[model samples]
Target chain A: MITLYDFELSGNCYKPRLLMSILGLTYETVPVDFYPGREHKSEAFLKLNPFGELPVLVDDGLVLRDSQAILIYLASKYDKTGQWYPLSDPAVLAEIAIWHDFANRITATASAARLGLSMFYDVDIEAAQAGAHQLFRLLDEHLWFGEREGRDWLCAPSHPTTADIACFPYVALSEEAGVPRQDYPAIRRWLDRVKRIPGFTVMSGVFPAGPAIEA
Target chain B: MNRPNPYLNDHWHVVAGNEAVASGQPFRTVLFDVPIIIQRLADGLRVTAALAPEKPLPVLERYGFIWTSLGTPMPLFEIPEYDEADRRNMNAGSLGVAVSAPRAIENFLDMGHFPYVHTDILGAEPHTEVKEYDVEVSAERGEVLATRCRFFQPRAATSSAGGQEVEYVYRVPHPYCSVLYKSCPSDENRRDVIAIFCQPVGEERIVAHMLQSLIDDVSTITDMRRFQQTIFGQDKPILENQYPKKLPLDPRAETPIRADKSAIAYRRWLSQMGVNYGVIPLVPRVADV
Candidate 1:
């Protein structure tokens, strides 16, 4: 049995939950009140994760701290198709690794802006929103060209990797942070593609897209 | 602190689609930051102040939209094709954006972003150029019109199967509303009417209503809607990320290019009309300062 130390609203927490859902793993959640309660920073929670983060995944005596590390472990173990986190291709693996780091940047900027706007965190909102836009512009350009080259997703070009899952949540919730996805048309289309991914679970803000009509 | 412009309050803004509120069902929406409710009657629709239940607001049903005004409004704009039975008049629905209404209208009037923003659907790279267009302000008609515009598109419409040079004519009939008359896919002699009515929900937020009246029998409603929605979806992010949220009416606010003739004319029209609900205060030049 697997367990996730979760916060309902946190995009970071949703990352592993999304991967686990896609992997068809039945995991229980220990809901941590991240906002009013601040339970993640408490003494008991501190023992689980010294970083005081919301997501500390415990899989049958194996504990993981970072969301990316948890994803790597889960995809390696449960993804039977070998498509989500295929290990044989070093090129694809390197691409996934780079995007995993890019996901962390998204957390710092887009998620930070979201928390600053909605949760009343002391964030440099203007700076954070600007940073998020910068990242989105880069991602949009990447995806736009990728589509032209017959590549649909971020990594592997043919099939969606864990990179798409990792980078999705914050981009979907960007409007909550006062950042609109207006200029990034490619990114908007990509979001719809991600929402259409099977086993996609809905959180507080991210809703499922309508059925995609195939060409 | 948005000072609701009296001029804008007096103009017809599209509040909802015809199907937005059902008969006997109360539909809720906000206009100029004041939340209002729309009640659909057996004959037509009635809008009332949510807080003041006794007062009935001025409402009109026209061209697949339910329009209302907070104050006494001028006449609504006209699209001649709506009256035609052969045209497929579709309400592409509404979407809320963080930018001011004028900004949304301006984005709709722009064709330069096709290659970059819309990519392969509306336009592709290496074929990027907005040919010169003629813009006019019809004082008698109370509208700003731009004609003789053209752009290369990969897929101009859902019915289109390949690339073609699309001709366009843009019109700004109201401060927050702009309409596009583009080449119809099935018919070479006729043009499709696409409009974006920006409802100024707040000073810096708007709900854009897209209505596409087309001369096409080849495409289904689903395909047409998906095509227009895809185009608008691409424009949303660019519109929201624009700084200040509100549009700058002053010609000096942003540099103008040959392709921005319609945008420039629209700004000039808004300035002439004194519509200031969602615009920045004009800045004095260095020489004047």
Candidate 2:
């Protein structure tokens, strides 16, 4: 069984949890009190992730840090369809890597604003919110054109890839940081599409989308 | 410090789609700045004001929407179009807009913005004029109505084959609810009814729920919703960037021309009803110290 050094409220920790759930893999969560307790900064947890992040996954004696890296590792090793990571297609692989980097940028801006507001972290809240809006503008436009072109997921793949999972949590939780998704209707619709993915689960502040109207 | 409730306590708001309140799962939402929780039990879904879970709020399921009234409210207004068996009923899903609920309702009632805000999808730059329309208050029915409006569009809706002349009727059945009846692309005699129900989460925030009841057999529910989402997505940014977050009820608060009849009538109706939940209360200018 895999073990996750997790914080329930942290969006970074939610990344691996979401992927693991989607892949239908069971894992044990070792709760880390990241807020008031500040346990992720504890000396013991640092041994697992020197970066002092909320999510550190240990699977079959191979320990991993970084939510994006864990998503890649999990998808590559377990996804039988090869659609999540798609190592077989070099071009798709390159596109997924680029989005993963973009996901980090989301963490720095959207997630940072959230932390500053909810956790009382020292950050330029205005700058972070502004930065998030700039990124969101690009994402909304890309998704809008993608919809017109009949593409659903972030990358060119017909189905969702790990990049969707990497970027979702922060965007979904951006409201807590005083950055509303109101202006990004495409992004909001994308969030609903992401939630409809099988085996989807929610972290705090991230609610499930209503069922799509059917026949 | 204590604060007065900023929401119109007596109005009914669409909180979610009926399908969203599934069994064994709880859905959370804030209406009129009050946190609410809805749970599906063996009998049916139970909705309560979050702070007083034991005290159940009045709930009604209609038009494929689950509605909750935080305070005493009259029965929901009837939409006669839904009774037609040939019509397709769809819940187009909820949207969050940073502007006030009243502003969203006004946007729904305004056709002047179609050429500019909605662009080629609903209208084109060449046809920016909103011709004169009739507006009146039906005191007996307790609603505001605008009629005899026509506009040219490149793509009227998702089902549009190409550009066509579309007739529109805008109606406000309640303070936070606005409905539109537009000419159907498929049938000349039939019209499609689209309603936008706004939930004022706060003075400057709203969650919009849409329902599309149309006389179209060719399109799937998903297709209908996709078309609405795309149109609303285009309007999101413009709605968020409006200078004053609240709807200014005073006519002098903002200039109004002939095309703004619907919006003008709406503001007058809201002011007469004493609904200030999302209206910007005019602040007196304190002479600069």
lDDT of each: 0.84, 0.83
- Mind giving the per-residue lDDT tens digits that candidate 1 earns over B18-83? 876788878888898888999987877789989988999999888888889888998888888788
Residue B121 lDDT in candidate 1: 71
DockQ of candidate 1 relative to the true structure: 0.04
TM-score of the A chain in model 2:
0.98
Name the docking class for model 2: incorrect
What TM-score fits each model?
Answer: 0.64, 0.62
RMSD of each: 13.6, 14.5
Docking quality category of candidate 1 according to DockQ thresholds? incorrect
Q: What proportion of the real contacts between chains A and B does each prediction keep? A: 0.00, 0.00
Give me the candidate number with maximum DockQ: 1
Q: What's the distance in Å from true for residue B191, model 1?
A: 0.4
lDDT, residue A57, candidate 2: 90
Q: What is the TM-score of chain B in candidate 1?
A: 0.95
lDDT of 2 by residue, B88-117 (tens): 988775766678888888888888888766
